[model samples]
Target: MAHIVGGIFTSHVPAIGGAIARGLQEDPYWKPFFDGFHPIHRWLAAARPDVAVLFYNDHGLNFFLDTMPTFAVGAAAEYHNADEGWGLPVMKPFPGAEALSWHIIEHLVASEFDITTCQKMAVDHALTVPLALSWPGADNRPVRIVPIALNTVQHPLPSPSRCLALGRAVHDALASWPGAERIVIFGTGGLSHQLDGERAGFINKDYDRFCLDHLGPEPEALVAHSAVDIVELAGSQGIEILNWIAARGALGPDVREVSRNYHIPISNTAAATMLLETPATLSKAA
Candidate 1:
């Protein structure tokens, strides 16, 4: 059976992509955020995940307000990244784990998640940025991917609790898969920051810290707040934390935080990165 290595959560702010494109890692403004990934790089080098299951929100690149599924899973052979006009360069195509993708799609449907299936999908910064951050190189990344997109661009987003359940269903699917591949789950986007409205540029450091502290050990505590409450407290876009919540659910009940870094005002977003794996995995690695 396939083995789930662990989960990695991070903020997928577009500006980080531009910083990489321009080689601005050492720049004072971007240095702190870029530096945070060094430990993640070391961990990936050791863990070497074969496939990445990304839980991310599309930003009008693949889905629009007129029509967007609450959840969509990619089953493509290859996933392409297009320029989203955010001053971020287009990224090389990411290879897809087609068999794994289909398996997850089937399992999700069987589990009554009512998710949309995409034979072809164009990924945006939400998916690409995390990949680039984790595997920084000019060539295509070594690992294949299965992109799972949740609707956060429009109203009626999936509740935090529902996303958590979706993650649990995915965990079950992976558990039943027969492949020997090692998998890593990625939950990308937000600590907190709003881009528009009178409360534009809003960020709640206290809330962000609260989430970072509890997401690994007490993920259920986060779902206690309704989706609306998340928006009001974390900001509208901060609802992206739902991605993190879902990723946490897939880790089973034994999670250990390996590393975490938090920095403020990364494009007005409270950027964060966390690495979590089973305590057994950590002990074995030790």
Candidate 2:
């Protein structure tokens, strides 16, 4: 059976990607933000999972107002990055795990989680930026990916509990796969800070810190919050924290937090990153 090595959580801010592309890690204004991802880079180098189950939202690249699925999974052989308006430095295409993608889709639907499967999808920064941060030279890495896109931008988004339940479903689906593969899950976006409207440039370090401290050990505490609650406190886009909740649910209760980093003001967003692992004993049992 396949084994889940761990889950990664991070903020998917585009400016962070720009910093990396320009080699501004040591620049005074960008130094602190870049420093937050150093541990994640080192961890990926060490663990080197075979596939990454990425959880992120589309920023008008693939899905626009025309049609949007609440939950979608990418099953294509490859996913290319798109120029999200500003023409951020485009990275190499991401290799996709079609077999695993189909398996997950079948399982999620059977488990009653309605999910749309995309054979061809162009990912925006929400997907590419975090990949750049976790696996710096991704083009040369051996990792494949299964992209799970959520609809946080539109209203009637999935509830925190529902997202958590979906994560648990993904956990079961991956575990039941009849292969000996190492997989890492990631929940991307949000640590407070809003853009747009009069409340733009808002930051709530205390609320963000509360989530970081509790999400791993007590994710249930977060499930009680509605999208409105999060938007009001964390910012409109702050509801993206639901992605983290989903990732936490997939990790199960027997996890060891490997490392965590949080910083404020990464281009109108508070940035955060965390690495979590299934305990060795739990992995063996599963």
Candidate 3:
């Protein structure tokens, strides 16, 4: 059966991608942020999972107010990056795992979670930026990806508990797959910063730190907060924390946090990255 090797949590700020594309890693303003991911890049090189289940929120690129699915999974054979009204360097297309994607969709629906399957979905920075950051060179990234889009942009987003349940369902689904493949799940976006309204540029280091500290063993503590509470504390767009909660749930209750990095003011967001794995996997590695 397919084995879930680990999970990654990250912030998907668009400027981070721009900084990388411009070769500004050494710039004093961006050095600290870029430095944080060096270890993550090395780790990915070693772990080398066969597939990545990326969970992110679309930022008005693919879906609009007209029609939006609360949860959508990409079933396409390949996914191209969309231009989010600005000229961001489009990366190479992301190779998809169609059979695995379909399998996950079927299982998620069967598990009472309604999921929309997309055969031709245009990915935004939320999906591509993190990939670019983690696996810098498009020419050499061998791992196929399965993009899972969550609706954190609109009102009535899924609650933290619901997102966590979805993650658990994903875990169960991957476990049931008959292929002996290594898979890594990713939850992308937010450590806390607002980009709109009068409260723009708000960064709550304390709350972000609180989330980073509790997400591993006591995820329930983070889940206990309502959406209103999350916005009040973490910021409005901070709802993206649901993605992290879901990734946490997929790894199950017991996980060893391999590494973590948090930095402030990464293009108006408190960027953070974390690596986690099942206790059994950690033990085997030891």
**Backbone clash numbers for all candidates listed:** 0, 0, 0
Tens-place lDDT digits, model 3, residues 1-286: 7878788899988888788778898999888877878877776767768999998998887788677888999999999886685567877788899999999899999999998889988888988878888777655566889998888877777888988889899888888999978888899999898889989988899889999999998998888998778988888988899999988877776887888998878888999989887765666467
lDDT of each: 0.91, 0.85, 0.85
TM-score of each: 0.98, 0.95, 0.96
Question: Against the hidden true structure, what lDDT does model 3 obtain?
Answer: 0.85
Q: Please write out the lDDT profile of model 2 over residues 1-286, one tens digit for every residue.
A: 7778888899998888877778888999888766777877776666668998988888888888678889999999999987787657877788899999999999999999888889999988887878787767647656789999888888887898999999999998997999877898899999897899999999889889889988888998888788788888899889899889888887777787778888777888999988887885345546
What lDDT score is found at residue 166 in candidate 2?
A: 91
Preferred candidate (TM-score higher): 1 or 3: 1
Taking the tens digit of each residue's C-alpha lDDT, what string does model 1 give over 1-286?
Answer: 6878888899999999989899999999999888889998998888888999999999998899899999999999999989899988877889999999999999999999999999999999998999999999757587999999998778888899999999999989888999988889999999898999999999999999999989988998899999999999999999999999988887777798889999998999999999998765676588
The most accurate candidate by TM-score is 1
The TM-score between candidate 3 and the true structure equals: 0.96
After superposition, candidate 1 runs with Cα above 4 Å error: none
Q: List clashing residue pairs in candidate 2.
A: none
Model 2, TM vs. native: 0.95
Evaluated at residue 181, the lDDT of candidate 3 is 81
* Number of the predicted model whose lDDT against the real structure is largest: 1
Q: Which candidate order results from sorting by lDDT in descending order?
A: 1, 3, 2
Runs in model 3 with CA error above 4 Å? none
